[model samples]
Every structure is written in C-alpha cells, then in structure tokens.
Target: MPEINSRQKTAIAAGQKVLNSVNGTPKCLVFTSPAAAAWAQNDTLAAGQKIPAGSRILSNCAVSCGALGASVTFDLGLRHFVTGAEVDLDGIASNVASATAGTYAANNGVLVAGGVDSVTTVDTEPVLTLEAANPTDDIQIRVEIWYLPPG
Candidate 1:
C-alpha cells in the first residue's frame, strides 16, 4: 500500500481530498545503485552474456553487474528499457578483449581491437550505434535496470 502523509489524512477527515478519489499515484524515480533489501528479484542472470529481448533482468538489493558488454547494432535494435521497467546501461557495449567481456565501442577510450561501446546521450532512454569491426571479433554488452509500467 502507498503511504499517505498526515496532511492527506487530515484532509480526508475534513472531507477535502485533493483529487476527490482514492487511487495509487503513478510515480517514477531513477536509481544508479541497487534497491533496498526487499527490492530484490528472484531471477538470476549469467554474467557477460547477451540476454534475449524478452528475458527479465533484476537487481538484488545490491548493484550487481547484470549483463556484461553487448553490441547494440541497428540490425539488433537499440537496447530497450521496455515499457514498465527501469534499465541501467552502465557498461553497455564495453569491450574487454582478452578478459572475455566485449561491447560496442565506437573507437573511443581503451577499446578491444574489434569491439566498441554503445553511446547514450540521455538517461531512461538510450540510443546506441555499434561500430563495425573486422572479421575476427564480436561485440558484448550489459544493461542494469528495474522494470516499471510505462507512463
């Protein structure tokens, strides 16, 4: 249940509810770290792997690295947060070459010989453009977020 402030209770007793109706308020908040103890999801995801679009990823009250690095290419569609969820693309498309971690990096920072990183200019919504690499390499990616109903 949603918590009602004291003011709301007083208003209710006085017959002066703000919206004149009692319903849960639709709300949103961005999180960079993990959620509280109860915010954990029971599902478990493997590390440095590409999770198919429909698979569910969750945080376990601790900011554990969800997906590793993956290439967000035009052919594969932009990594989506899917309506009704919050996704954190901390190392989206990061390239860890020999470390077994790879991502889409557009020739920036220390990138894997054939890998690149996905870029995003905005939070909540991420738009990634993967760079093409030689025949010898592959891309990797990881995304972190909480699912929520789209507003």
Candidate 2:
C-alpha cells in the first residue's frame, strides 16, 4: 500500500525536498533564546568546521516590553592545538521589532519579530536568518527561511 502523509507532514516533506534540491545543500537555521544574559552562550558550532564566505547568520532578541528584541555579535577563533576556527560578530542582530498584541510572523523571511524587518534587497553572498518573537521571554528562535546557494 502507498503511504499517505497528513497535510502538515506533507507540507514539511515538500519543503525539505525542495531545499535538498539546491546546489549548496541547505542547512536548517537555528535559534536560541535567553531569559537573561547569562543564558545566552555560543555553544553551537558550524558543522564540518568550515562554512563558505557567502553564508549568513541572523539573530534577534525577544522581549515582552518596549518592542524588545534579541541581538548578537559573532566572531571566529582558532584553536591553537585543535586547528579549528570559530565565528565572531560584534553586532550580528539586535533590537529587532517584536509584536505585542497578537500572533505575528515568528520567522518568515520577509518579516521580523515585529512588522519592521529586513529583506535581502540584493543577492548578497552571505545571509543569516534571525529570530523573531511574539513578545515573551519564554521563547527564543533562529529562523532559516530559504537558501539558494551561490552560483
């Protein structure tokens, strides 16, 4: 018998199949939220210890007051003995708008936490999809909308 997938599962499967077709082989965007500064940490690392230049990273803060948003700075460090590197940023994503009253776009490529957002005006080489919130500290996210590898 042929297997049947539910609507939601079907949607996800279709999305994954499409992404897998891309030339660069897309990776899922990851998000992290913190209730306090102490909770935020650069614990995750890029797979395979290497990422190309045209790659991108997006980040945002989540808050319940004053349109609070998340921000991050990234940098790369090289281990003396391990021979691996890290990514560093001074101000990767910060002060992104957030919605307070109703359900809002969480991580759509076109929208930020709040209605205010940033788009890839041009085919910039490296882009990082950031996080968006519904105005609560209970959640933190990293959004990966869609990626088309560089030609």
* TM-score for each model: 0.18, 0.26
Report the C-alpha lDDT of model 1 over 14-64, residue by residue, as the tens digit: 997543112233222223312322211221122222333322122111122
lDDT of 1: 0.28
- The root-mean-square deviation over C-alpha atoms between each candidate and the true structure, in angstroms, is 15.9, 13.0
lDDT of each: 0.28, 0.31
Off by over 4 Å in 2: 1-22, 38-51, 55-96, 101-139, 145-151
Model 2 earns a TM-score of 0.26
Winning model by lDDT:
2
Question: Could you give candidate 2's per-residue lDDT for residues 47-86 as a string of tens digits?
Answer: 2232233432232322222223344322221121233321
